[model samples]
Target: MPPTLKKSDFHYDLPPELIAQAPLPERSASRLLVVPPAPAAFDDRGVRDLPALLQPGDLLVFNDTRVIPARLFGRKATGGRVEILIERLLGSHEAKAQLGVSKSPRPGTRVVLDAGGEFEVLGREGEFYLLRLLGEEPLEKLLLRAGRLPLPPYIQREAGADDAERYQTVYAKQVGAVAAPTAGLHFDEALLDALRARGVEFGHITLHVGAGTFQPVRAETVEEHRMHSEWLNVGAELVEQVRRTRARGGRVVAVGTTVVRALESAVRDGELQPFAGETRIFIFPGYRIRSIDALITNFHLPESTLLMLVSAFAGRERILAAYRHAVAQRYRFFSYGDAMLLFPGRES
Candidate 1:
């Protein structure tokens, strides 16, 4: 393998028009760039072709963490506008988040919520602001009525009615993630049914993707970067399914990088065991994966950790070449863009 690449190695020139503003008219209608083992093996296909892309007995692991409407716009007691992006709920009434405003609101400042409720900025802990929701109604209920979908920065638009459905995966059930697992966004009911009909087994894990996912790395070297910790749960049932799939000589395909992290985080003593905890694993080049045999992910931002993770899964050279192909073909980039099905090697 080549030496660990600098962040600049993953950089590419993407046209502004290719950054997807809205999802494809249909969820499964988006393009799929197949990065085969060799240059001669490429195929540009639609997401509907997923059933034909894989063999029988492949275990598709999905992150079922639902994206909550975590973004909220409100006003302080002084009438200054502020936007709060919830990171995670620390308790029923307390949470941590990133506050965006012209000026940072100091502790004990009251901010009126969009739902007619209010909150107090209790204090700060590191980069997150501690917020205390002040209302008789529960925090989740308040957010359900007033919170905006925290779409990525690249997607320039106000969250509309369609965004509530389009930004989430068809199978998303556990509500925690601030960001959607973009790879799973392409899987509609019809495509999932087709895959299941073609004998693909599916499993579910949870990883509440935090707001830090959108934070860029400022460090020079890969080792200098501090990964954000996210909560993950790999239950006993999913562990057994993975073990059983491997026992039968089947491949375990992660639907997104979140699934890969959750699966790999669960492995203890060379075998995957059930787990429920926080993980700060930063996967870059030279990191050997233990659980995921293949990955399906969207094209990531230039010089971002997500790009590095994909480079680690496949070799850096292969992924860089694939990105060039994707950009040259005018593939949409970022969260709501097209996806790539990556097989690191022939053997699992």
Candidate 2:
């Protein structure tokens, strides 16, 4: 990590209009910016050009976590409206959530859902409030029946019918994520098939992306900030695949930051191992990245932890230069935005 990391060091200006409000007609139709490790003009390309950028034997590790419809609308005992975003399910009928009510409710206060069931506030858990369902109905199933897709805050619009499908990756399997792994969103079934046919290998890890991913780093100094923990699973299969790739001299190309975090966290003890647990591993500039040889990610918000992670993988100046190019080219930004394929810079 950098000896003196400032929150402002990762800042970059982006035009509001470039923030994509919706997905492209075809998932692979979007653009991809190939950023090489050394300083040079980035290759402006399309998402479909992936085959040309990556070679055979290289393993593309993707986060297979699915985005759940976690947003719910309801009201308080006083009939005041409240919006709930389930951050994590504690159990069948219990969850930790963020309340959107004007006034915070005290413990034991009941909230009735407009969609269906009712829940009483159990207490506070950091920025979240613990809620236990009044009835025994499984909270996860109820969320599927009642919750709305919680879109990113920057989208500036309600999630439409199309968003229900477009906001998720075609390969999404394990359902738990609150936000879509935007980089994975670029690979539709056809593109995945193309990559596989081109001799590219695939591996999957689960890192259920939380709403906290959108939260800004409020700390003046980056090291003072703490990351929100998210559940992840790096199964034995992926571990073996990574080992095989390394032995075969193939690159381990992480498809998203979540995948990078999960893989990097798994190798915390200096070597990759199967891991399944919550991780708050924060990667910033000056951190030696030994997990992945390359990364495929989306354009992130300025000063965001995601941006910092990429800056750590590539050089801070290199990443900022790429972002400036992305902006000047009017490339889309955020979850529904365009993608980038980055090669690693020298580790400090």
Candidate of highest TM-score: 2
What is the clash tally of candidate 1? 0
Candidate 2 colliding pairs, count: 0
Candidate 1: residue 309 Cα off by (Å): 0.5
TM-score on alpha carbons, each prediction: 0.96, 0.98
Angstrom error of the Cα, residue 248, model 1: value is: 0.8
Residue pair clashes in candidate 2:
none
Question: For model 2, how does the per-residue alpha-carbon lDDT over 1-348 read when each residue is reduced to its tens digit?
Answer: 237989999998888999999988999999999999775679999999998788999999999999889999999988999999999888788888999999999998999999879999999988999999887789889988998999999999999899999999888999888999989999988899999988999999999999999999999999889999999999999999999999999999999999999998999579999999999999998777899999999999999999999999998989999999999999999988899999987547
lDDT of 2 at 127: 93
Each candidate's lDDT (Cα)? Answer: 0.88, 0.92
lDDT of 2 at 239: 98
Residue 76, candidate 2: Cα error in Å is 1.3
What is candidate 1's CA lDDT for residue 116? 87
lDDT for model 1, please.
0.88
